[model samples]
Target chain A: MTQPAIELDGVGKRYWKIQERSLLRSLVRFGPPNKTELWALRDANLLVEPGETIGIVGRNGAGKSTLLRLLAGVSRPTTGTVTTRGRIAPLLSVGVGFHQEMTGRENIYVNGMLLGFGKSRIDTLFDEIVEFADLADFIDTPVKFYSSGMYMRLGFSVAMHVEPDVLLVDEVLAVGDIGFRIRSLDRMREMHRSGTAVVFVSHWLQAVQLLCPRAVCMHRGQIVFDGPTEGALARHHELLTSDADSAEYARGTVRVENRQLLKLDGSPAGTVQQDSAMIYRVELHFDESVESPQVLFQVYAEDGTFVYQMQTPLGESWRTLSAGAIATLDVTFLPRFGGGGTFRNVVVVTSIDTSVTYVRDDGLAYFVEPRIGAAGLSDLEAKIAIDGVDRTESRPMRFGGTWAAVEGA
Target chain B: MNNRSLLISLAQKEFRVRYKRAWLGVIWSIALPIFQSAVMVFIFSRVGRFGSGSSFNYAAFVLAGMVPWLYLSASVASSTTSIVDASDITVKIAFPRAILPLVSPVANLFTLAISVLILFIALPIVGASVGPRFLFVLPAAVLLCAFTATLGLALGALYVYFRDVKFMVQAVLLVWIYITPIVYPPSALKGAAPWLDFNPLTGIVGLFQRAVGAPVPSVRALLVSVATTLVLGVVAIRAHHRHDRLFVDLL
Candidate 1:
């Protein structure tokens, strides 16, 4: 396993929230820093073997950046130890630290050196880098004249070419055009296949699913779940939907045990034909008597793009439940729009007053397959009619071979 | 690559960027100091009693002193803020933090070398002789760069923690030149404050002035400069070694 390419043991990082910044105050700051301590990360532990790819998913400020920084050796852990075996390259940001006035050619050398490559090494890799970034003619031009995508491309190329043993990528892949984005991911996969330990951090769950066999979910500076990618993601969603008292109400008041997105025919359906009716069912049991619970459903496309959401009104008021009662609620809808890709259904059962959520069963992966020739978010079939004549495809016939018609067409 | 190459690349970027955008190219880096020295020589020559003496070619004296002093002031000012200024880069990626402040001094060395070439070419024209003493500028230049880097390193590291250091360095550099006997000579401070010899820049400026045969630098001043350089150099290198990985936290 190559002795854990990266390992963290009881790692913690403490930062001071200084109230004031002055030379005089700092010189005499012997009395406890005149500030409060913020532990961005605490007692965190991780071990990544060579050739392993792991995904880290977390909300903003969940210490993800802090964790990457420590692993990159950019920041030292305040309490414990962080150790790595080989050259560590941080794709923490896209082309970070690029000097604006320097040429693309020059910035590459500078950035490469910072990533632990020598001038000769960079020189050898120079042609490949320039070609990879697709900036052959413009490599000598100062980067200030380059577009943001060019900058990102050049940066990604240099970092990838370094062949580091440990790669820490943090949310920087979300930019540039889709073609380059896919290429970058492919290059990362190539590196991973060659024995580099990859720590991938992104909010895109689909990306996690595509890249990682195992994923770690972080919350409030600690690893909340670490196991199969699906389980970690499910736990992350559970964290997102419920508060601290979730378990209390989830088990005692009303508990949603299972949920499913099924075709109206009652067969399991992950990918169904567009415009077909499907049923989202949430099966729950009441441990204690409760009245008028609100149920919510949300649908999101494969890319984590929000699709549609619905909630029972403030009054499902007439509805009531007693202890030991079990019920199944079905939401049937024809997904007329929001098609073209895999989707998922999330069901949340909350208290009537909206104070607490009892359960959120979110791992129902559903797919609204792209209808054969359909494209975009939905299949909005449009047939243009002019003067009561269907002329959407009449351009060639109406214009025929007329010279003036060619320009108009 | 090794740290040495990284340092070289960083310095190369700094050197190239400074002169690349100007219409005059690197010529401006050489010309601006000569212009300043020309004016200082003209004024100092007329007011000989305030300078070293009528016997000395004050023009050569000012050029030698001005080159290092100008480099020091600019380098130190930039170093004071280098760490804080690069917080964005520092926070995102990890590298040796000490190198950030050192980059400015190393970059300035390119311009300083060009200015020194101009200084030698201008010396004979200003009635100063080119003799065996000219070789001394080699050691003196090294000393000047080393001193600036160390002072800057210490200041840059401190600046990250104490935001006031940047302004304080500027305020000090403003009054520092006049007190260091750059335009005049060390003899000018004989009666007013002999302890002025203890100021580190006193010996540094004294060395450059001596390179042009302006005045003999006092032993105390040289000792003080070396002493201060050692102390500050230690502080700078040690701070970076201990805090290089931790600086990102504060940033």
Candidate 2:
């Protein structure tokens, strides 16, 4: 019967979009200023137990930041209630309240206090923060001179040392060098293991999948889906593709329809195994007559990294399509993604010279199971030997495995 | 208690950062008021002759008035925009937004203290002896700070909603010094001296002048100053309590 670390009960935040704020105009006019209410978040109800790590996935303007702000207690919800227990540390972007002229050592004390840490507590944790940030050399230098990466590292380092009961992170994981990024992830994992509740918001779905067992997907200021990370990401992609469809429709040209990722036997591919061949099938409806149309196939990792791309060779004539013609296209390829994760397959139909893109379809999103013990974008099938003993796990670790198992294997 | 420490640390940061790059550092805190006081003494003693008929040392009187005036002007100007200037932190972290506007006044305390010290030292050199009445300076300083802080807090909240408050504050400060009996004694206004009592600063500044042996201001003026501070303090506290979390929305 322990209290949830964080709770949101029918919470909503509304912002008034005021057209203009002028003293004279307000005094002269009898009524209030012209304004529209924008609900950044609405009817959100959530409960997170201690030690739970939950991810939030959504497109831009989807209320992720609004939810984080609420959880951090930075803004009050216009309706309902948001309750968080114990100390809440928000690792927002870069340094908050960091004065440019202040040295790193000074900023640490100031920033730490702003996070509700006392002076004596900061004194005890100062060295650890500096060491973690790897800014021992620049600790005395003003922050204005530090690089953006250095600034972010310092900010992140301080928040981690706070040992907060509830941690709300917003897009801060994407900064810093690769080494720091890995160290941060490790620090977050350590915090997770220590029973801190974490609410992580990120567009980096791969990181989300690696860290969070559960996730909430948001769209248009509402929670569209809340469940496992896999299902949330699937829902997110559906919204993204649907949004793309409307944008394409506005262009008024060839329309890509009925896109599907199917196994060799033509059944819908739920989860394709590593190196397994699959076919991306789609139909193209042309509004006007066109010469030999070119096809471009692209694959993107869940984090939006462009994995691979192929296009029709120049000067190759497949066939001409007349007005109102319907053509079926099938692209076959082996999913060679390493450390398998969810991926998106996009198909673009363009003119022969590749100058005019008639339609771009991003409908087919599928998961690839990585080879045993394999991780990363491409499965190079890397093997390991330690002191003349084979150390690689025979059963390769697949995508969506537990974080600890992935690290241990 | 935690928030108290936060306020102190933020004020410390503001104090340190302001002088970090300045070549003169904190000396400017003492020097700026002395320089301004000297200029006023020169102009009024010769050009206007307003202090010729006064019984007290005009230099000390001007310096006394300058101490509170400078603190009020600087603190109010900065505190009025404190919340908006700190949008970076306000939009992310949660804390008492009142601390933001209060920091400027608290941070300027160093300067206020330095200016007051300079005034005490100049009093004897200008033939104005330090009397036990100078004890009034203590309560005077406290009231001055309270008034500035409360005003700053209320205006800081207002500025978040209407940016015009910044310019309005600046415009008011420009005309405020003249009407506050800072440069000229209330007696200089003759029959209009009673009207000057309506200005809240008349009572606070009169305390400083009284410390230097000038005639005490009307009792009504002191009440006016106290009442204004109390009212502004209540308005400020209420505004912050209601809008502390909501300020981030506008930010």
The list of candidate 1 runs beyond 4 A from truth reads A27-33, A243-306, A309-409, B46-49, B52-54
Candidate with top lDDT is: 2
Off by over 4 Å in 2: A30-32, A250-253, A269-274, A300-307, A339-344, A352-357, A360-377, A386-409
What does the interface RMSD come to for each candidate? 1.2, 1.0
Residues forming the 10-long window of minimal summed lDDT in candidate 1 chain A: A394-403
lDDT of 2 by residue, A1-409 (tens): 8899999999999998878888776778867668899999999999999888999999899999999999999999999999999989999887866889889999999889889999999999999999999999999999999999999999999999999999988888877898998788788878887889999898766667667878999999999898877788778867776675554543456888877778899997665777678998988888889899898999988778999999888668878899899889899998987777778888888888888987777766766654555668887777788998989877421223364466687
Cand. 1 TM to true fold: 0.80
Give, for candidate 2 chain A, the lowest lDDT window spanning 10 residues.
Answer: A395-404
Candidate 2 chain A vs. true chain A: TM-score?
0.87
Name the top DockQ candidate: 2
Leading candidate by TM-score = 2
DockQ, in order, for the candidates?
A: 0.64, 0.84
Provide the global lDDT of candidate 2 against the true structure.
0.86
